[model samples]
Target: MTDEHDWAPDACTLPTAERPLRLAEFDRLFRDAVRDTDRPSPRRLRLRLDDAAEPVVRDLIARESACCSFFTFDLIRPEGDALTLDIRVPPAQVDVLDALARRAAPAPRP
Candidate 1:
């Protein structure tokens, strides 16, 4: 996993010391719950997650929003038990979104 500081932008209000912990949280979510990923636009990312991940996803996004107000998160329930999370940022924050997309990407099968 990349260092916590690598993708975090200066606008993040989260304290420096807590950055790693936050990054770990995201990594955990990405590694365990993310089923697929899609980039609808430069500033938008979509994550398809297992139905069981809804609670954790909600909590994580809430906390992330507290620190990174520039982010816009939407949780959607599409037919059955499917869950989708859409995240958006301003044009200036496309790089941050790009970094997140990289992290959320599934690892290649050996």
Candidate 2:
């Protein structure tokens, strides 16, 4: 069994209405990452950041991508010189999101 305790945030913390809109935004962001790529893996979601701050987001992204990790999902809000990735899962994306994310981030076909 997996640790069941990755770094991804709890989805329960978000208010109901705010969650959906954010998911939509996140969906758009994720789609843009692997756009016109190839087949996506069922366990990954690529976040397209306007400013990922180099190595910082990459580390967080790695943490979230670990297997059986619930905390892999995060919300990135960038303003001025600050960027915050609020780790939380949306109910809509719980398990299904991963597969859909793969569809969003596809691998290039040969």
- The TM-score leader among the candidates is 1
Error of 1 at 68 (Å): 0.3
Best by lDDT: 1
C-alpha local distance difference test of each model = 0.90, 0.43
Q: Let me know the TM-score candidate 2 reaches against the reference structure.
A: 0.34
lDDT of 1 by residue, 1-110 (tens): 24435688888999979988998999999999999999989999999998898999999999999999999999998777469999999998888998899999988879
Candidate 2 colliding pairs: 8-71, 38-106, 38-107, 38-108, 39-107, 64-72
Give the count of colliding residue pairs in each prediction. Answer: 0, 6
Alpha-carbon RMSD, candidate 1: 2.3
Model 1 local distance difference test score: 0.90
Count backbone overlaps in model 1.
0
- What's the true lDDT of residue 53 in model 2? 46
Off by over 4 Å in 1: 1-5
Candidate 2, RMSD to the unseen true structure: 11.0
Q: What's the TM-score of every candidate structure?
A: 0.92, 0.34
